[model samples]
Target chain A: MKSKAKDLTDEELHQIVEKAKAKDNRALGRLCEHFYSKIYRFIYYRVNSIEDAEDLTSEVCLRVVKSLPEQKGLFYAWIFRIASNMITDYYRRRAVRSNVTSTGDLIEEMVDEKRTTGELLEQQELRQAIKHLTEEQQQVIVLKFIEGYDTDEVADLVGKSAGAVRAIQFRALTVLRNMYVRKDGKS
Target chain B: MEQNIELLLDNCIDEIRKGKSIDECLADYPQYEDVLKPLLQLAVQIENLPQPNPSSEALSSALINLGKEMERNTAAAEISEAIVPSQRDVLPQKGFAASMKKRKTFSFFSEGSFRNVFRKSKLAWALSTFLFFAVVLSAVTVSANSVPGDILYPLKLATEKVKFFLTFDSYGKAELRLNFSDKRLNELVEVLQQSKTLDTSLLKDMLDEAKLALEENEIPVEKASILTAKLNHVNAYQKTVLENIRPEVQATDRKIVDDAINVCDMRSRWMRRMMNEEYQEQYDEQDTTPQSQTPNRKRHQPKRMQWGEGCDWMR
Candidate 1:
């Protein structure tokens, strides 16, 4: 739960939720002033598309409304978890539709069309290296290295022991190292 | 021969992640200086790239949508509440009372008993069946577009709220958070129970809270299992009590994930199941661990993490 203040604190977005509970229209309008943009940028970076980012962002808002009266958690992670699930589900469904071909493979092939050659190569390597990792390892690594969450948050996001997250991180890095050397890039 | 700094690899990864020059990090950890320098440099080169950040407009726009959604929900609630008492007058005057008032006309349509039954039977039954088929077909068609995307749950404060629109893809899936109050959690348990994906820790937390309210409020035992069975995952947002929900939900989630495995089992295709099982087992395993078991790793890695350069980093 967020702390209450006489005047709404900067983080006092919950004020909107409270007013919303009482069926207050203006308070809900105030909430719209607060969270929409942050959620959009987060989705933009994660999915890397302007259109998809907008859809996921809107979906997140709709979800927040229908489920607001019932949700519990800090504002950011609560929403981020929702966004992550949405993205993961999207990938899973896509993977299914594309005849079982890995999204990572699709990422590599699409890299040239989507980004500069330098980033293209970098993302390509990341795509290849990620495939070699266990899915858990990949998720933690994505949340940590790619998504900019710290170790503690990554553990929270994945619902695992920090030690387990660490060990997975260790293994993930080792796999990348192997892939790097195996390609003779470092050799 | 080069030194293996497996112990130092962890910190080195952190250093690499932080965008520090490998040489700088090498000097920071003097004890592993010799062992970690090369691995550190290689990792630094690889992981030095910038992380992505969302644009400034994203959060603001999401908040506005939330406000719109809340206003809409509140209006809907109010409108529904205002109309409940008047519903009787709203229905058509074609029921038993109307039939009695028009009894004289009724006999003209059916004076001969069985003749009355046969009067409009064909027409009425035809109309009823046609209406039913139309409804069923429309419902199926309307429901076809519905997936997990419909009815996103938002977080409303038990008391005002804090919250979103995230991103849109070509498919443009909207993201919503599920927020529930203590009492609402009980109701949610029922809903989630049907889908079998409710967050069990929440069920348990709701149970405990419901228990606390026992002196003032009674909680049925059946509600507890109903709560527990429907939980699929836990959220970061929490009530004043039971902040430890993440691990609890994960523990439960790990179990429900097996349903997918059961699906895999249903395939009867040995190759697909075997491969999926291999992946599923690892995630299913992570789904359950004690809450306290998380967040204890030392920030320092034994060595810097290098991809493509030192698969030997582990060695």
Candidate 2:
């Protein structure tokens, strides 16, 4: 379906959000349709499984439908915040259930079914490198590079200063480069 | 040293995102080339990394789930709206100036001045109080015999609802509901007698509500006996009406009519028996009175008691 929200300007997006707050099902449906792929993609990158990503994406949409009336910030930020929290909770629950300590072990449990053999190996290596970084560093890198958010947007989402976000990204890139070099040397 | 490099790297990345080569970007800042080169290369690699795209199946599934959630929310909102209409529905939709004028006119009553006049003048207060009750009593009396087709029928229903609202205890509410149920049957009978088309659904709903009230067993046997007498009256009318319209009524409506008639028959017979037991006890009490004191009156009393016993069915 063509998303009514995708073509909407900022003012039009705000209008749709207002209509959604008034319980307009059509507007809410449009918003859900527009945001579903983005949210699912973000969750897929984090969880590495289509099924889990689909489930969490629906959960985020449900929360958005419920909390949209009370929300008082940028719509994208609010939505991403909910997705981020859900991802955190998912990991927390999985960690508790499996009692696993290593991030590689967690990633191993969530193999991407879509990738070919070589692509899967490269992705696994990339995820392994990302998993070694601190959680804050990983978030900055994902938001800036993967999600294509600006420094200020990343700062706002991560609750850090813009400069701090840049610093995190710089350090994250340096560490990731070293890890890639090491992996190449080993090979 | 680190802050300048971070700033320079941020600028370099911005330039790269805007379509600048690493060599061109480094040409402007050769001093930081060695440090910036690897980092910029990694940035480009990260940017080019294979980000996962949600499958079409996943997207469609999430949309379906979201649609269901929105539907559930809309249904809940509709139900709430039906139960309690919003302020916009209840209040007048006049402009602000009109509302302000109304507020001004009512301001005297809202403040203590009008209340003080009523408080200070005893006769004025008493007269106002009497007028209020008189108007209410007259409205209720005028609306008492109003049937479904009558203009006063809505008023009658509203009055009954007010009574239902005022009655606190479960048994009281049940009895009132039963009374309203009897009224519904009376309305149905009136419509039939006038040869007007009857509202079978309304009658059915009222009968169902009445049955629910009786099944609750909230009222005492004595109180229920009165309802039983009313039910018998309804039963007699329902039977007569059903017999008159049996050929003309649709099959579906006939079933509803039949169920109502059956309920009336069952409940009325039970109530008659209960009333008989009660009246019999009363007759026994009167029988113990001395026959020597008034012999002629005592002889006639048993006949009178028997007549009263049969009269319960008529009621």
Candidate 3:
């Protein structure tokens, strides 16, 4: 499902950061509601675990709160840096558990749901197709289509040049189209 | 530019943007228009996958944990300032008491004073005194005269020269001259033995020729020279080394004949080394620069380090 564009704009988010740095709890709460789903989904795709994603998403919000005291709170790149660190740390903890064990297990858990019959069947097919896509394609597609971050924002969050992100996005879309499209007689 | 595929994908994105339902995403993407109906149905199913939103509690807990870390860091800073002592604060440092500190170092040592001279280490004092007496004694000895041990010196020298002479060859009255002891015969045998190509019996014949090598044409009493002669003689005697004594005789005789010359050379060199130790300065004076030595200093010696100060033999 698509997200409603929030009432607050990017500039408002900037102000909320400044106010939060000044210890404005209400403003910090507003900031949380705005980016909460985003931070959650970004982590969900990365760790592919409900528990870990929840933990890491909260971890990102906490870091924003703690670090804001010293931060001038110009968080365009910095806020995501905190989120990135959390996601990175989450992976580190998970890595020690058993060997990654299964790449799709956690993502599957995060995305699995009860659905109508046709939708469910179609979803299984698409999920299978997604599973076949390369890891980088999955990441880019999630960062763009899933998280709804613009290409450049996603690039900054992912620590890659925007043009490179665009390239990855293009390739990812192409792969999705090819698999989901399923041309004329053959699967 | 089929742009057909690109436009199709764009329409699909637009359909998703409008929330037309995931069903329309594939149909709107004209690139897959041929199979868009089925693909869209599949896409809808995928869109239905539950994306669990992280709970509100997680966010609050994260905030609490972060607050704790910040408080901990602040406490650490405050504690650091409290512990560090400033110089202006007149409290005496318990770790560095002035009374227990070592005395200041001297810039240079005292010169020509009794205290300074005697205060030198005992080893240094002993070495200096010994060197002083030795130098004085050596100077006086040079002023007077002394002699090298002359008794049997000529015999020792003659023996060496004779040994060296035997290494080369010369002739005598006999056509096929042979004598291991005669200097000339020894030389001839050396040439024969060293030849790369020669008759097998050449050595045997040469040994027989050793009979006349001595001064009175009589054999010397010394068994060493006689053995040396026979060792190379090739024909001196028919002893066959007497098979019963094979191993012992071979080891003794071979070691003597083979290793004797090398052993003598080494011993002579050692003797020269000892004599040089006794009269090195005299030899230095006589031939100061047959080839000028650059310096015998070790590579690690600094420019300021003096040879006399740390010379290995100063003691």
Candidate 4:
């Protein structure tokens, strides 16, 4: 579906942000619409449940709408920060509710779902493997490869030097490579 | 170096981004082909993973939620503005308090009635505040011993973040990070010992905390050296513990634990190098620049050989 927010240029997005801050309901709706899918996908990759992803995306939207006037720094980066914190909180709540001992169990539950086909299962495994990396590594991998950001763009979003981002990407890929080789060996 | 390899990998990635096949990029660097091929393939795999879009229903619901929140926030802002004392309200007026009383508006905050209510409730307020602190203190104390899956563990991590943010001194922050790393390691050990499923995130969190601690600047050289030495000792113990637990970890989690052990090994070597450099600087007094203030020439540390006695980086 064509999105009004997705078509916006940097200058346009900035204008929308300013207008949204000034209480323009239409601008605020556009801003939320623009980031909705990206933020949802970001959370979806980290989480197993689509419902959880949607709920968290909504919570992030609420936070963005409420906090936009006082927000500083890069807008995309700020949204990602909120999304990241929400994921953390989501896991905490999950931990409290389910008392699951490990992330591996969660992955297994995902795998055991009736709706997961072989391809979807593989995707789920890959996501789980990515979670094994450090948070910085995960951020670099997701932003650079999954989201198709360049190294410098990722560095800007992640607040790391370009060199650091590359190094992180390299290490993350190395770990992922090992996981894949192991899976191949098992099969 | 190692930095060159990172750059090379990045260049290959850029080429791939520009529509070159992975094989073509690998062909350009045959010397690194063995090292780069699998990683590039994995990168491509990740890139090719299905890009999930939010369902239209979700989008509409999110937009509705945003609209509701915007309206609520606007209402809140207006209400707060009206309640906030203005210069006009501060000026002497005869019927202001009476009118506010008749309307039961929030303007009663400026009237003596609010003060009388506060005075009457002082003991109750004090008692409730004390009870709140008592509960909070006990929860924090209990959370200190909680592990990753425990109900109180999130509180423990949150309390740590709050403490870390409140600590302004660089060295103090660094120390706090190291301490938190230690806590994570302990949690890992506890989870392992309890035969609970291994939480790889905790291991990753531990490594991240240590990395942040080691990366912190602005500490005195002597203190940094001491800190590194302390970290080295802790890391050594961590290495030993991880090695001992290797056989017990489930097959699925073995790779993650191995990666964390590799990180610990790398950190150990980095600390060793840092301590050596500090010692060398101390001996060579002619170089007057403080070692801590000096630009870190070694931005990328080489990965060390793994533990000895047949212990490799991974299976």
RMSD of each: 41.8, 24.2, 26.4, 37.1
Better of 2 and 4 by DockQ: 4
Instruction: Rank by DockQ, highest first.
Output: 4, 2, 3, 1
Candidate 4: residue A186 lDDT (0-100): 57
- Kindly give the number of clashing pairs for every candidate: 102, 0, 12, 0
Q: How many backbone clashes does candidate 2 have?
A: 0
lDDT of 3 by residue, B1-315 (tens): 334444454456457656775455554345566544443443334344555466656654554454344334433433344333222222222322231122112111112222322333334546667878898556544532211233443443344355446644322222123332243323323433454222223223333333233222222223323333333332222223212222432343433222323322333343344344435544564476556655332211111212222122211
Q: For residues A1-187, what per-residue lDDT tens digits would candidate 3 score against the true structure?
A: 4553457787877787776665544455566656777777655655544667677777777677667777642364566567767766765766743223244543444354444556544544454555456656656666666655565666776678766766665555556677654643356
DockQ of candidate model 1: 0.10
Candidate 1, chain A: TM-score? Answer: 0.57
lDDT of 2: 0.66
Pairs with steric clashes in candidate 2: none
Tens digits of lDDT, candidate 4, A14-126: 99899778776567767887888878877766765667778899999999987888988888888899999998888787783331124553454455544455666677678
Q: TM-score (0 to 1) of chain B, per candidate?
A: 0.18, 0.39, 0.20, 0.53
Q: Point out the higher-scoring one by TM-score: 1 or 2.
A: 2
Error of 3 at B46 (Å): 5.1
In terms of lDDT, the poorest run of 10 residues in model 2 chain B is B298-307
- lDDT on C-alpha atoms for all candidate structures: 0.46, 0.66, 0.46, 0.73
Tell me the tens digit of each residue's lDDT in model 1 across A13-123: 666567655544344444543555545545544453455666687777677667666767665567667766776776675563222234553464455256566765675
Model 2 iRMSD vs. native = 9.1
Model 3 misses residue A153 by how many Å?
Answer: 5.3
